[model samples]
Target: MSEKEEKHVIPYINRELSWVDFNYRVLEESFRKENPIMERMRFLGITASNLDEFFMVRVAGVEDQVDSHYFMRDLSGYTPAELLLTLSQKIHSFIEKQYSCFTRSVLPALKKSGIRFLKADELNESQKKYISEYFDKILFPVLTPLAVDRSRPFPLLANRSLNIAVRLKGEDESYFAVVQVPGILTRFLNIPSEGGNDYILLENVIIYKLGELFELNEIRSACTFRITRSSDLDIDEDSDDLLIEVQKFLKKRKRGKPVRLELSRGHDYETELFLKEMLEIEDHQIYEIPGPLDLTFCSSFASMPKYEQFCYRPLQPVYPPSDFADCDDIFKAIRERDRMVHHPYESFETVIDFVRTAAEDENVLAIKQTLYRVSGHSPIVAALIRAAENGKQVTVLVELKARFDEENNIMWAKKLEEAGCHVIYGLVGLKTHCKILLVVRRDEDGIRRYVHMATGNYNDSTAKVYTDIGIFTCREPYGG
Candidate 1:
């Protein structure tokens, strides 16, 4: 290839940047005053959550290439380091907009609606009393404060967990320590009162009481921060046991390399430098968030039943088509022909019914299914367990490499195995993300097969929100 020809620009938008743009569009919805307040907050939360995963997986990959000295530009024509620098600039701007939308647009609207966010400066005597008591009773015992000095090393921080960085004045020198905000506790705390309702950030409450945690030293300064780590799971299919390999991957993922750091403005400068050097993160990777570190707490607001008036009208999952509406025999309906249901508008019951029907049917011989993710109770999993317990051969490919869902998949896989079903992790070097379910059954004619396939996981809960298409069929091409 000629040098001139090799330097030609590709006529395609970089996918990572494209994805960031998509998330920004979602963030824009929060700026709309006409939209229901809580619903808009959910949009803000979704934006933040999307960015977290974007850094963990997408940005992390680019950084890995740069680290390995692999500078080959993609079709989009940006080298790894160049792309990272561009993405970091875009992200910094995007996050500034998010906080601007929250503080200026959303916060004002929320205040008008009787939801007030009183900061530490605005806390009244009663509010301070409540916060102090709450901290002592709830947060204090769970809080593990790690101080970094010559003798003590910096503690490993979890991916995306919020922490408070504190600078304390020792006898002769100032040092830094971190207090991890308990993830189990709610980030937003409501102060009870009849005059009006108010809430405060959990991190602010801790920052207010840092002296309690570090009584020996004078409190210099403190601010909230969070870090995102690379969370990709590599599957070794060549390994004798794929499930065991996934378990090992899950442990390593928690301690994955730091890809992005979100620090709130106003932390002590020296301590900030201390963290940057200790964590070994580049300048572009550090994000100085203007307001709150995490907006996912806003998404939780959408679930409050009390805020129904401030949210959109609830949408229930619609029933299946008229033909299969009252059908008692799901197997018979599938045997006759193919049936497809559009989820979120229609229902996910058809898929669940197929599995449940097969589980109970004495004529059923075997059930084989690929599970990517499912509901909490997971009727699909329960049905598979029932089938296995009833002496029906059951084979399940549970993809433990499903990002952020490895632990849940691992738990379900063990249950399925204990229930006497054959649970396989999936193909080595590749994640089996395909959603397919097959049930072998005995019919009057001979051995027949039933199949359920979908564009999404068989999670009944998400079916109401995530638009998906699922089909149940007994056709030879699909089921055979």
Candidate 2:
């Protein structure tokens, strides 16, 4: 490469490594003492959630390239295989730091704050008795132990699902089996204790009563493991129907190629070898965690009641915000001036009211919106449905390829269609990510159009956490 060419070689961090670094910044919050303990725990959970997607999409894509023998380097100058190798090393080290923060820092802080997790061996006699009864009544019936033998083969575990790989011993030979920790149940079980908010991990409870699950054989050892699979949808843009194509891919996503495996630390060699072989994963893909398999569980635990002192003071969205404070009518507010609503600080309710009012308004002739992602039981979708039901011309572009939100989007699309709304599944080769809403109405003067444009989704649930800005405008140029 000549000097001129060398200058053109832009020096940039590998995107995969850069993403790991980004997640590390989130993990750094858990290490900070200044932040509230539960808030710090939430940040840790956020990092875990972020890494899960990184592995599923980014890491999985690289593996596909390596499998196809694509040796071309990225802008950062690392080939597919090289990038994967470097990413594995970077992620492994990052994982070590993550567990260190969780076990050494977060757990101790949580204990100080009246939250404590007891191990199986640390349980008192009464607690053990309670656990036994709970297992028999609540767990046993729901749990199905899948045997792993020559005849049976290892089960196809669901992506991100937690399972316990159990080693059992019979009179003549040893056997291996798997019991998936029920996802429907809570990850942490609160138990009766004298001191603090005492709880034990659901997996520990199952591990304690492994013998009951495998009554015919003696239980040797059991360890919890979780797998992150490649979940990126391979959309056939040329397919007959994009909705049906996406639905097909969503089914295939359940059993997509495994990208990362998380196992509990200090497992037997036999169990480790068995898993690696069965999952067809390299050593780099396996992560032996020192603490819990999935820390995302902590995110929900952070919201436990009566622990407000250990969490940040909740910021309530200022209702009837300055933009809409003087005027109750959404249309009048927009007609007066271009109003910008800063979310979380200001309310998302202003935008919701806009659609809702349009639905109810007798003069409103039509409404249009693009939904990329929305909350479960979205109010925006409900308002759109209401608008359509009221005989207003309503057209909604619900992007079905919103990554991890396909199923929810699909469900909302169906509801919108059923409610007599013209629902578009989005463009064939592109995802409609813009957040815009348009309402057409007849004013005292003539026909007019009002629009609400935003930097975020119409998800009211996320409005509390995500800082997004939206503008309400009735400008002639914008309307046209």
Candidate 3:
């Protein structure tokens, strides 16, 4: 309240708002005419994915604070409620900009480049016949229409699952039902085209054949909708077993309170109200997307082989990098001098080979590493298991709390434990974020230690895209 105190408090951008701004900066890449069309679409998808996480974790946390009546102002000097309101406005405007770029710029460019998305009405008789048969053979059998009535409560929809809200005319009165568009199938269906590749959204195909599912009643209206649920875990550090607690939390995460609801543009008013009431969300939380419910699908669509010419040329990293070109032995290369590997430019295989060598080397005594996030079929994890199986001591500190990667890490932890490796589930209330690998070997001189440190996770999948620096050293202080 004092003038001096107020002056000392430097005004800073709110973290939530700053993150949204960062995503907007990413979105700006899509608007650039110089960038390849496919790359621009990929950038747009990245923004949508970023916004989804922002709502699930950041917005959900602030809403929690507001609900608890915690009015304390952040360093940015806005109360929880005020920040939430500002975020709602900022996010709505950001989404509008996202769709504007998609519709005005990306769609036209894609069409010009020989890729097109045809609507239901645009299809010819042959296409319609093909779609109808395809729907019956492929979609009809898999689709389950869940009717919402007093007897049957609204289905507990999973977070982010796209569903169709169908309004049907009953014998007496009208009611609503839900038909989940299966995520298992592809989002875009490639049908026969006269010239270039033409595709139809699976949702549109489903909407066109809704009468098949509801033969008893007349279909009135149907629209695609998706919900983002709160996924930020509330950890109890005092739990008896952190792994089991995290497992329980993971289940809760799937059905956590709905924080965001996305509906197709021009959604029915009655249906929208029904959804809002069921999800317990406000008007600001509801986003009426002008195009698709989720633009994340655009990333995969951009990777089509037919659109390869419109995409940026892929870069291949140099194998057996110059740093280790002189020596065949990885240990000798590190022992001679500290070597650095720049990722996505120099291959990540150098790092994997380092671990594989440690696992296979006769003189190597122990291998230790920290795993934060890894690929589904991680070569690094396989090498660690090999090290343990080779009778060398292997200690792996698997960070189970890694966001969206808990399940994968858990599976790897169990595999490592079964393979006789010592697995640590990280420290309580703190994430093990550092990327480190230490190999102890009994050299002729004495016991020598080699270390591999990096700025990114040991995930090979990400290494192809992320720019990271990794260093291999056998000298003191660093290896210490």
Candidate 4:
């Protein structure tokens, strides 16, 4: 390469690799002695699950490019193929370290705090009996076991479905079977233990009773595995009936090709090979997690009521700027002066109250807002409906492409449309990511506009935990 060419080469870390490093920092927090034991465990779980998605969407996309013989290179001068190999190695090492931290460090600390995660073989007979009964009553009815055979084609494994791979043997020959863990049931089932303790994971409970579901004369081996697919929604902007097109695309998301497979490390070699061939995944794509395939189960650690001491102390959200404390009229507060609201630290109720007051106010002319990821049973949606009912002009831009939240947004859009609000399904090509609430009012001077701009969604439930910033203003340029 020429000297000028070498000089122009900027050394930058690939975004994907940098993201893994960021998650490593989160994993490191789990080892901190200062954090509450449960909180540390929560951090570890979050990091692991975050990596899963990163590989599924980001790594999978690069792999696709390499597969297609595309030669595009990144800023670091690494082609897709080169980067995938590098990433796979880096991720393997990172996951190994994460599991070590969890198994070696966190688990012991948790045990000291009297919070225990009982493995499948660790359960006592009484505990086993309780778990078995719970499974029979609650879980057995929901599971579907699919056997791979000449008569039955391989069943479609939906993205992110946790399943059990079973090796079954009949009188004639041996075969493979799959049991999908039901989505309707909780991933972690709390088993009653003495002295306010809890025990269970749906996987272990299922493993204890696999024979009941299979009905096979003999079972060779079974292991838990999960698949993640490329969930990036791609749409042609020029398409007609955008809503119809989006709905069609949403259906395809579930059946998207498996990009990553996570199997328990102890899975038999034959069964692992079978999964690779069946799923059409290369060996490099399979990750052998040491513990449960999904560490998301660790979120259940938050449920132990007796371990309340192993959590962050709760802090009540403060009202913004004390001036609006008694005033039912939000417009009056904005008219007085500009205000800023910090979230999780400041209340989201003020934003809801702003919309609610406008809906109720006779002088308020219209309200316009953008909806991204709103909390379930959103009071904000209800307020907009109420505003429309009061004959105030209401317009809402609902983003239907938010990951894992598309269906909820679609339902909300239909409800908003039915309520006579002018609902827009966001811009043709771009997602309206801005969180904004605009209110128009008629006062003695003239028509005035008030705007609430937020760094986070107007979701009250999340506002209690997610640190975000928002501003309530009626200043000259911003208000106009």
Candidate 5:
């Protein structure tokens, strides 16, 4: 290649900024007038939630490098610090546009469709009574108010945990206190509306009853805020016990330093300053979003009865091949030909059935599989357990370090162990993300090896949403 041709070569988009641009496209979906109002709102919410994770893990990682005075450049020719600065500005502008779209367009459309989000003051006497009852019965029981003092010390804020900071004042002195929003409870509280409409947002209800939580004569200020910590996993390849090392890292993740602080719109200067000082965050790290702090609640919009007309019509997944439909013997079907299964479009039940059939077959000698992420109630895991119980040599390579799925994977590992399956925690340095299942069966033509390779998890639940591909084959060389 000539020097001019090399110079003209297109550089890959910066992964961080490319992600943000992808989110902007999602946001644009919400602006389509043809889309159902609720669906649009859902898209907007997804965009918000996507950015939250991007900042928490990706941007936080770059920021860490910048903080350590290490200048690392990517294919885009931007250093970590340079990228952080650029991302901060871009995100602020994007969020401003998102808020405007939500408040001006989606909210009005929702109201027109008989769903209303009422302010505390707008609630009628009956509505107030219902909300108050809910507070006393549910919210009040779960809340633990933590006061900031010389003795108490600043409490550790878990990543993405929603918290309300309150300014309480007595006759002589004033102080601050924090109350975490419980994760177990739903974020949206659907209240009875006069017509067909409904009211929601647990935060709005909590803020309405702030005076009840505190014994201050004058409740000076209360603002809802959430902190996202640096949650990128860093593993040492040289560690002797990789599983133990990952567990240690997971524990440390809970107390990771705050990388991004999200505050409600128009947060008081004093409260902002206090948070910045206490959390040791720079000005660029703070983001002020109008409306709710977390947009994951937008998922609830899908449940809105009247708004069903606005969203995409649900479709049932189909089996990829018709031959497997009649022949229940998956091994026999695979032995005949190679089969490719498209997921979200193709039924994952076929995958589950393959495992179930293998577990029950007396001819099957051994089963080996790699698990990245499995469903909470995984049929695949059940099949593995059953195979182990039947005395089949079952070997499972469970990636214990799959992010956010670590705790669930740990639980599954223990369950598999109890069932007598030999479980491996995966390789030390590299994550075993590849999805592979190998089955050895004693057939009429001697022992044969069958394999299943998929682009997605064997998790049945996520198969309904994420698009993925899977292939089942007994072809020579490749299958073995």
Candidate 6:
């Protein structure tokens, strides 16, 4: 390598630090004064979600290099350990700024908009009584307290699960126990208020009721904490039944070693020591969050239905092409000329209806598609099932390793297989991220093929929100 290249004098920024800056850009959206308060809150939620994935995949990779003793410096001229230290500093600063934006700008504005998030101490007597009762009646049954000691080892905490580590004083010596906030329960709980928005944090609720959980011991201190574990899937592309292997690894991902620990500040001494020793994490791995352990609850908060006025004006999908609207038969329109549809700007119904029409068309011979990430109740999957049952040859490529969508895709794959569709797990060592659909019809021209292609997934639901381009064509060059 040239000396210039060896010295990394190209003046490029660190990839990891650049990614952290990208997340900060998302956080900056929350600071814009003109944007609606709810939208800003959603932006904050997006940044949090983005950071979670960053730690799971990106940060995990750097940590692996450090663990495996791969000391080679990157093109940016930093060792893995040095890069991690730099990333840690950047992440801490970015997160601090994130919370500052939320608490300073977003929270006060949300209050004016009649949305209120109450802490335990901030609750009125009636509100406190109500919350306490709600906790005893509803949350108590789902709670399990794990005590850490010699015979009874610490429980394996689930990745990203909010938990409260309690320091207790007993007859022998002070010890620590942790209780995970139930995943099934919503993090934000709606409480009765004087006609405006009122809610409580689930962690706060859990904290208030900790005394009941450990009635036998003295409650010295209790604080919320969460951990991010490496969730990157290691797929052996050469393995048989890639679906089964991916499924196997998906289970392992939940138990992957902890990569980042986000502990709510003001942890008791014993609690902090226990987390350090039990998780076997480094000091730099511990992120002392001054605010909430997780900000993902903002997503559900922003989605509250009653106040559309407090959010961005909903943008409706534009009408499909004039040719499709002007022509009675979509197939005839595609065959006559190529067509393009822009989504969020253009309705996805045209695409859905095209498939639906083919399912019912007796002249159609076959249907083929690739599904990566699909909606819960996907109309495309339904139509494919209909086509298969009607004796039309249906071939569907369902990529089972679509990251977080693995379980959902697996379900859809099984359904397609049961419906008699020729379902495949997609090309080995490659994710079928491309969006394509092919249909063959026994027209008067013998066998004619029509294709629908896009730069995005064929998800009708997301089409209303995300911008994408799609085309419908029967061009011989494309079909061939």
Residues 221-336 of candidate 4 have per-residue lDDT tens digits of 99999998877776666787777877888888778778888899889887898889889988778889898777776666664576678888876887754646666567777888
Q: Tell me the spans in candidate 6 whose CA falls farther than 4 Å from its real position.
A: 1-8, 476-480
Q: Which lDDT tens digits does candidate 1 get at residues 1-480? A: 888987774798999999999998998899998899998999999999999899989999899899999989888889998998999999999998999999999999998888988888898888899999999999899999999889999999989999988888888888888899998988888975555568998988998888899898888888888889998766576888877887898889889999988889766678778889988988888889889888989999667787889998867666665547777788888877788788787867767777888899999999999999887899999999999999999999998778888889889999999999998886767777788998888887778788888898878888888988877888553234
For candidate 6, lDDT tens digit of each residue in 96-135? Answer: 8988987888899988878888898988888898898899
* Winning candidate number (lDDT): 3
For model 2, the superposed segments whose C-alpha errors exceed 4 Å read 1-9, 170-173, 477-480
Weakest ten-residue segment in model 5 by summed lDDT:
471-480
Q: Estimate each model's TM-score.
A: 0.94, 0.96, 0.97, 0.93, 0.93, 0.95
lDDT string, candidate 3, 1-480, tens digits = 899888878568899999999999999999998999999999998998988988889999999999899989988889999999999999999999999999999989888877788889989888898899999999999999999988988999998899999988877877999999999999999888877488899999999999889988888889999999999978787898999988999999988999999999998988998889878889989999999789999899888787788888988998877787867888887888999999899999999999998999999999999999999999999999999999999999999999989999999999999999999998987999999999999887778889999998999999999999999998553234
- Residue-level lDDT of model 5, residues 1-480, one tens digit each, is 999999867668888888888888999988888987777878987887788778768988898889899886778888888898999999999988888888888888878877787878888888999999999999999999888866777799888989998877745666778989898888877787768467767888888898888854467888999998887888786888877877888899899888889999887777888788889999999999888788777767665675677677876898744546676668888988887887887788888888998999999889999999999999999999999999899999999878879879988988999999999987876788998999988887777889999887878999988898888887453334
Q: In model 1, which regions exceed 4 Å deviation?
A: 1-9, 476-480
Candidate 4 Cα misplacement greater than 4 A, ranges:
1-9, 170-173, 303-306, 323-328, 475-480
Off by over 4 Å in 3: 1-10, 476-480
After TM-score superposition, the amount by which residue 200's alpha carbon in candidate 5 deviates from its true location, in angstroms, is 3.2
Error of 3 at 350 (Å): 0.3
Ranking by TM-score: 3, 2, 6, 1, 4, 5
In TM-score terms, candidate 5 sits at 0.93
Clashing pairs in 6: none
Model 3: clashing residue pairs? Answer: none
What's the true lDDT of residue 333 in model 1? 82
lDDT of 3 at 187: 94
Clashing pairs in 5: none
Worst 10-residue lDDT window, candidate 6:
471-480
